[model samples]
Target: MGNIKKKKMIFLIMLFIAIFMIILAIISPLLISHDPLVTDFENVLQKPCSEYPFGTDQVGRCIYSRVIYGARVSLGTTFLLLSIVFISGLIIGTIAGMSGGIIDTIIMRIADAVLSFPDIVFAIAIVGILGPGMKNTLLALSVIWWTKYARLTRVLVMAVKDKEYIHAATMIGASNIKIITHYIFPNIISPLIVQLALDIGGMMLALAGLSFLGLGVQPPTPEWGNMLNEGRSYIQTAPWLLIYPGAAIFIVVAVFNTLGDSVRNLLDPKHI
Candidate 1:
């Protein structure tokens, strides 16, 4: 249908954007024309010009350079966070679902307790208690986030555990580990891929929010959220400070969300 074609086209465009962003992030240091951390008070708050495509910030740091460098921090942190959450969740969920009984009850209960609270609020509390820093924020978010993966993985495993194919594998003397890695993972990976794509944007926003609140990557680090926090004061005089970084976040998040939607549609059984 026309609708599906349009959707696929949008997905391809967004996918290109996403890949470009990642490439930029990887080569940010080489791409930056100015030293992101170094300040040039002489040219402070200069508007966009031939020398500075995105202009200078309040402290005369190159906004373009900072934004580019910030991409590294934001994307790296999101990828690390996702890896931690996904692996921990997958392992715990697999154990619970495979073992069942009291182990499942205890793990589910713990996850339930964590999930009951608003995620941002809980993250704030944890970071506040541990003192505001990037490491603490990463640790807190990782601890909270793994539960979502665990729950999903547990359900997926349970759904496939009793399948006739799985039973046949068991009867043929295949090891539990082998069955899981070879059979279970392949069957459930489509949903996991969809979840990963969906979470990428959310994790990015979560890190940005924490930084905006002064609890994430500290200032002078060239993080987008920290840039936004610094740029907030000059919205009237130097809107470029906010505009550039904000637009970066918006574009990246939109690209990721588009990818997530595309993945979900492709994986959805009804669509197939």
Candidate 2:
């Protein structure tokens, strides 16, 4: 009982943090300093003070501004990535599961083949091929991320399709598309939600990783990962540079993971 209560408290804290991060992301543009890209050589490497709460970067760009803007980038990419992956996954997974037999085997095997690749490596290859910048990142994420969703949803669809209601729908001469859209998807929505929520954290981490590797958000763009990358060289002289951005990434990912877990538990109470 004590453990349960503690877990609940932790979950709530995480949920609050997630909400806070989201709010920060939404209001980033208004909250940040004038033009995150604008450099002030005089203020370079300034410590946290009344004027710049988070301090200034090595190049005199406001840390506070960059972080707020980076929150926007992080959250925006998460949403866009999930949207693309979710729709593609649902369609492919639904078709594969509902069709079954050779079709199922073929689709699942393809997904398995894709999944066999190390995620970061696969993303890097795709991004490298597509060249750098936001479009390439999105393209890379969409290409690789869909496989997990497809696999999970395919399995889920298979399980849900076997249930009595699905059988009843089939017996009533419902078309495969209708049966799937009306039955399988609704039943599996909970898991999909959980998957999406969890994937947000992973996606954010991936985005940051890509930026750190010089393949994601370009410099002067005020992205969290890029900011961290800029800070790496200055770690010996200005540890705060790395600390703030790194902390942002960690906290946001932790929040998403916690929220995902809470939602999963709530949706599947039997598991809890």
Candidate 3:
């Protein structure tokens, strides 16, 4: 009983943090101390101090402002990616799962093919072909990442489709839509939610990586990954530029990963 309470408490705390992060991302522009894009020639590479909390970068942009606004690029863009992939994957997976046989086989095979390549490698190829931008990055990743959700959705659908409740529903003449909504969706949604939570950090890294490689959110724009890339040259002279942004990614990623675990454990019957 005590453990259950503890688990709930932890989950709530993590949930709050996750929400706070998202909210911060939403209102980031207002929260920034200086224009993240505006460079100050005089203040370039200033260390953490009264005026610039996280310091100024090589171009004299506020490291603090960039880091704060970076939440939008990191978390905000990721949220968009998550939604796009989730809906598309859910639809594709549900169709394949319900259809089964040839459709399922073909879909699974395609997914397997996509999964075969190293993720970042494939993403690079796609973005390369698409000519590199936020839209291309999102499109490339959406095409790549949706496969996991689709496959997971299909598996979940197949597992529950044969259950006793489903059989009972069929015997009682429940409409297919009714059965899906009343029974199938409820059972499957929990896992999907957990998967989404776990995906936040990974998706952020991928976005940042693309930016780091000069393929993503292009320069003068304050993205964490790109910031790191820009700061790499100045690593010896100025470390805060890299350290602060890197820490932001690490902290946000850790928070979401913990949130994912919290959701899973809280949802587990054993834990309850």
Candidate 4:
């Protein structure tokens, strides 16, 4: 009972933080007091003050505004990447799991080939080929990230396809599509949701890392990663430049990760 209460408390706290971040991301534009990109070279590297709550960067861009706007970019890209990966993985994994033999072999082999490469390395290669930009970065990430979801979904589908209800559905002449969608899909959702939550956090970190390395969101954009990259040189002179955006990334990622773990614990029968 004590453990359960602790878990519940943790869950509520993490959930609240996650929701707050989402809301912040959604309404950041209205909250921003200055133009994130507009620079005031004369007032460069100003310390935190009422005019610029988070201070100013090397080029005098408002760190607070940029950090706020950066939330949108970071969350937006993460959502887009997640959506593409989830849908493609679901479809491919479902098909491969349902259709055994050559189809399954082919699909799994392709997934394996992609998975063989280190994720960051593969993403960098793709981004390098496509040229560095937000769109290309997302595309690169989506291409590499889908393999995990596909493999997880495939494994889950395979494990559940032979269940009694699935057999019953097959015996009743249910269409393959209907069986997979209505029967198999629903059963696998718990684990998928857990994976989705965890992956969102992971993707946030990946996107930030990419941006920090100058392979993701280009200059003048108010992305946390790009902001971090720009702030690196001014770390000693303008620590706030690094702190605000770095803290933002850290908080968002930690929130998702904590929430994901809570959800996984709650959903796992072994934990119960």
Give per-model TM-scores. Answer: 0.96, 0.91, 0.93, 0.96
lDDT of 4 by residue, 173-230 (tens): 9998899889998899998888898788899999999999999999898999999999
Q: Which regions in candidate 2 have their CA more than 4 angstroms from the true location?
A: 1-13
Model 1: worst 10 consecutive residues (lDDT sum): 263-272
lDDT of 1 by residue, 143-226 (tens): 899999999999999999999999999999999999999999999888888898889999999999999999999987999999
TM-score of 3: 0.93
lDDT per residue as tens, model 3, 108-202: 99999999988899999999998978889999999899999999999999999999999999999998889888999899998898888788889
Error of 1 at 32 (Å): 1.2
Question: Which residue pairs show backbone clashes in model 3?
Answer: none
Predicted model with the maximum lDDT = 1
| Candidate that beats the other on lDDT, 1 or 4, i.e. the better one | 1
C-alpha displacement of 227 in model 1, angstroms? 0.4
Q: lDDT of each model, Cα atoms only?
A: 0.93, 0.85, 0.91, 0.91
Candidate 2 per-residue C-alpha lDDT over 1-272 given as tens digits, one digit per residue, 9 for 90 to 100:
77567667767887888888788899888898657899999999988888888888987988988888889987888788889999999889888888899999998888888889998999999989888887899888888888888888888988888899888988989998798778878888988888787788889899889999989989988888888899999898888788888998998888788888876665665646
Q: How well does model 4 score by local distance difference test?
A: 0.91
lDDT of 3 at 233: 95
Q: List the residue pairs that clash in candidate 1.
A: none
Worst 10 residues of 3 by lDDT: 263-272
Residue 183, candidate 4: alpha-carbon lDDT: 93
